[model samples]
Target: MNLWGRINTLRNQIFLGFMFVMVLVLAAVGLFNYEQVSVLLRSNAEKHIQQTAVQATGKLDVLLRQIDTFTAQVATNANIQRLLMQEADGRPINFEERQLLQQEVRKHEAYTTGIRSIELYTTEYRRLLPLADDTLESRVPDEWISRVDEGKGRLIWLGLDPRYPDVVIAIRHVRLIDRSFSHAGYVMVQIDKSYFELMNAESAADNDRAAREYMGLVDESGQIISSDFPSDIEAAALISRQETISLDGKKYFAVQKQSDTTGWKIIILTPVDYATEGIAVLRTAIIVSVMVGGLLFLILTFILSVMITRPILNLIKAMRNARFGTLKPIPVTSATMEINELNHTYNQMVVSLNELIEVVYQKEIIQSRTELKALQAQINPHFLFNTLEAFYWALDEKGEEELSEIVVAMSGLFRYVISRADEDEWVTVGDELEHAERYLKIMDMRMLDRLSWRIEADDASRCVPIPKLLIQPLVENAILHGVEQRVGQGTVVLRAEPSGRKGYTRIVVTDDGPGMNEDKIRELYAAMESGQNDSAKGNGIGLANVERRLRLYYEAGTNGLNIRSEEAKGTTIAFEIPGEQGRD
Candidate 1:
């Protein structure tokens, strides 16, 4: 339901593919938009921090100007000037004058907050006066005194007041009205640090807490003047010019501006995580949307793929069944038009193919019958051959025993050949041997002591059926071509036994006579291979026909004749037939 799982099936894979494409597109668009937004957000964050620093600096400028105005007012006060300028016979001022000067300084001190006190140092009188309650008289360092003396009338920041470290002092070398900017006495103003601290506190409070921001102020020497940040952060901010930097391996965004009044840098530090928090939220939203969309897409893709594939799968099943001779028309149920058309075409092909098969089968039957009748017509020579048998028996009745025996054998041979005229007829090896024996007898009388024959067949072989007259033609060939032309008596052997090849009987008709040369044997083999029955005198009854018929009956070339001959030696011709004894 959540879309994460194995995609092993076709529908699952298709669904996964759709989901994958969805994810890719969403990721591409999301990442691109996120990148752009992130850049804009980050840029805005930097500019915001910079503007915040500038605003803080503006606030600090106001406070610094107030301090400057306060210092200027005190230095120009008439009572304080007159008390410091009055010389009482080169001695310090009396208590009454001092009290009057203190009252004037108090007026200036009242205008500022957290001012510990105001004092006047008259080097000409060597007198220090403190102008407020809780104002202790302490020895001021000569460094501070000399700096104030060197300032002429310009105010000088004396760093932090040592006795009141929380306060900063500003001083101006006071000038008398003697037309001289000489070192008269110095007017010093003490301002509390809480003013600057308040400025920073207010600036940080204005920003959101999630921003994790803090501010710092650094002098021109990169020394911290006022801020709430840690020392390390302040140090890092002082040196860093980048809008963003890593603090202790964590990212931070920093921006700074220099105060026009104090020449101090105001820096704000915000965690990068805080700045890009919006981007993270946006990215999460985008991912969630993509997941939901992808799930919906996957469901839709699965449904569509199933709709498309189901009919095609059925068609495939039907086609597969067709391979095993199932030529039935496939049922048309495809939803798609093209697939339905394909199924229809397939159905037509099945019908046409079945029809063609039937037509071919019928034609083959007719051809077989025609061929059978043709062979029967050829065997119909039985009439003349049978008439010759009448003559043969008639001669036998005349009591010429040798002639009578020959005639009887000829009659039996003719009967055997005529009985087997039908091509479908099959005879056992023993019956075929008997037929060959009768033909040999006839040939023996014709050759007149020039031919002799023997038939050697195993009992098991004798029952094995073969095409009728399968051996007779080879026997006739042996006598006529092998013995009839020889000067002395030649022997013909008819052998039937279990062939060396399994499941077959080997029939060899060998003749010992003036053997043929290799050339004549080659010519006979060539004619047999070509299936051409050359009507040459040496090839009696055409050995090619006997070879072709043997091959056809057994349906194997190895079952056909093989002739082996040598000049002046002998010729051995052999063939094989099925070992089945029944007349199949």
Candidate 2:
């Protein structure tokens, strides 16, 4: 009421209208421009980073392929092959043969700058050849030797040599023909880790000197092979590949790519503030201009609103009194033509509204009485029972005992369903079981030998009170959707067990038919919990309605209905209700 009273005045209305329009225009124009500029800047930065990663990955791949080719040439050399063959015969490698093999290895070493050194070894013959000044390793690292043995003649990229962190080795296992291509030895080619460092240095030199972007290469095992970024910055990027992250209390934009050849991830982090410094300056200027323009416009609008609304202020005053009681005709005293016209229309509307009230009241009373009678007539049990009884006599007179029994059972079902119209809407457990049995009998006659059911109830649970029509629909759903859909016979079992909790009984309806999948079970349970009936997913009202009726009377924390199912297995539906167990 206080808010309405303040806004009802002409002065507050004019001030609010002008202020709203001025602020809305300023905010809309400033925010739209700012968003467009920011999106463009971020998109350009990401594209630049992705392109740089691709270029670096291509150069590294070319260098790796060249090294692989050189190792293959050394592995297939004639002198190396003859020595490996002679070593397989349990004979030692002669000094002259070793000299010829070293000459072949020297011939290949001069071909590429990427190769730092080369070594040859034989496990059975105990022969070693070294091409550099560094001493040959006492024994081949078992980790490297085992990997090469399993590589089946393919080159395996070893990221870093364990003994010498500065070296990266690409090794191949050599198999001699005399040994039936079995384990002879391995050929190791070592490349200085610094060989890849030059690539990063060249990339940095090619970019602008003022560029704030940092790039790095990381291998599959989370090792930084080459990077110009600080150690902490590189480690953080390797952990999470998000588009934006915080580093040293400042935000940065990050982009990453995985190399197809070497399986290494390339990451680039560019400081967001540095990249968009120009945008910040432009945004500040735009905000200042919008504020100035809004201030001038607000002043002019406020003056115009005051002049235009003075005459309507009197009309609003008269309308405010109309909320409490009947609206009488309003007097017109304004000099403006539109104000005089508005007062005349408002008076006519008041007179017509008074005349409409009595007629609408009379019609509503008639509608209420007629709807009540229609609902009562719809549930008349005598009408339904008489019709079923006539059908039963007709079937019996025609000597159709099976058909007569079904009609008799259906009559009992309708009688029980409608006879509780005046009762308290609760029935005993035995009463609900009788209704369910009648429904199952009708279904058994309809489905022939494909359906079977059993009901087991303890003597204590039979006398417990529950809502009417609780178990009938569940048994019906089990027969109709669960069993009838399959070719073979399906069985349904209804059991009432005493729950561990005091004053509660658990009832379960289980079926041995093809059951629902995970998605279907979830959809059914969701519909039940939300009290929505979705007809597309099998009889929405059947299970969901029963679940609601269970929850309406029972206590909370007890599931109204729970469904468990597996495809091609079966289904189980159960619920617990508040009831005493000792009564018989």
Candidate 3:
């Protein structure tokens, strides 16, 4: 069968409907749980990363404060201040003063672990301490001196000096701790970059090397002062408010905390995949469960559908046998109550069908006998024709020409009416018009000057086939009811021409006689629709018979006969006959 027919079967309907509903439920439950788990896991990951950022920032701030305190102690020392004052007076630094300043600088450097070196500079940018071998630049940058001045005794953090890119520097403007408290010199401290890596090491001690979180310190200018993931500094520094960001096409959650003392941001980047790894496992489990459950549902639904439709299939097989003239009844073998009821109804139907067959056979036999008797009683047309011919010759011998003509016409009309059997219903338009003319000729002869008639037709329309005797009845009605009732002479015209519709011919019979009123026309139409002979309406029976025969012979919806009349003007009756190509 076709697609619709296959889908319409009871087995497929039940199986598909059950599977559809099962899949919907499974999908809904799986999706709802997956989304809930995803949201909860992401929220927890964010909170955890945020706490890590805060802790890392706190540790770095503590280290920075300790370094600042150490630098402050060195800048405020009495020996360092007196030496700076003596240098400001343009006095040459003696061995004693230089030795005392060097001792003070060395003493403070030993107190801080990550400090590379400590140097003191005069107000004129001259170094006052002994030069260290690790120092890259002998002279302090003018930019550093200007920044120290801007600090006005407070510590100034200079992140990643180009002159010594391996270390971060902090500077302070030193002033005399004497009665005047005048400006003296500057103190600078260099801290090794390795000090920043300790934060990451402590935070990620439990994590594997591949999945460890990266921690970095960025200055206020978005420059990386120090970081374990230095290559990602540019991408990480751009993250401000977003919880997660993509770096080098891989997803990472970013959390940041700003230091209150140093004014730098401490950034922590954790990989998104590692944070949500458990959620991925949950998603996989949901998918596998749905697939396994769907397969089980499919198999169980198919089994149930087959069990439900088996009895119906058996009923269909029995019905098929009955359709092929087998009147045997179906046995009630199913345990289902509805199936048993259906089988019982089918058995009753088979019993009634056999009884109907018997009754139809008896009635057919009776009808055959009645038809045979009627045929035996029918008169022969040739016998009537010969008798009418004999009367015509007798009248001619008595010099009754008008009467002989009427007899000849009468014989032709009778022959035409009875010539065809029931099967031979169609006749050419020419033959039908000729038969109508013969009938009209007889009426004309009897009425004399009071009756006149004409026949107009084209050769094309005359050859077209129409139902036999369709034209003659109209002519008879026009004469008997119209012309006979008129006070003066009346005229009847018959015309055959192409109809307005393509492939059809119109034949109209018109009379110049007293016409019918609306009520009379309605009565005629009622009699025609009822297929009855109303003898009180003089010509209604003939017109009704013609209209009925036209409707039965022609295709349905064909305009059979149209009657148009005025009170005293006349009446016109017209109808169309299909052409050869138009007929069924």
TM-score of each: 0.38, 0.39, 0.44
Instruction: Single out the weakest 10-residue window by summed lDDT for candidate 2.
Output: 131-140
Tens digits of lDDT, candidate 2, 521-558: 88888887887764435543477678776666664736
Error of 1 at 568 (Å): 99
Candidate 1 lDDT, 1-584, residue by residue in tens: 12342323445555666777677667666755655665567665666666666677777877888878887787777776666666522566777887887787788777687677677777553455763332222445677667666656777775667676677777777776553644567777777766776244454665556655667666665666677775566565455788677667777787777765455677777777665556544665576666656766677777767766786788797788778754888676643556667988988988999999999999999999999998777635667777777877788778778887877787777677655434568778899899989888877878788777899988889988777777888887777667765778899999998878788789898987678887888888898889787544644567888878776666653557788888777788887776753454
- lDDT winner between candidates 1 and 2: 2
Clashing pairs in 3: none
TM-score, cand. 3: 0.44
lDDT of each: 0.72, 0.74, 0.78
Candidate number achieving the greatest lDDT relative to the actual structure? 3
Candidate 2 local Cα displacement, residue 203, angstroms: 3.5
lDDT of 3 by residue, 65-91 (tens): 888899889988877877787788889
Score candidate 2 by lDDT.
0.74
Using TM-score, give the best candidate's number: 3
Ranking by lDDT: 3, 2, 1
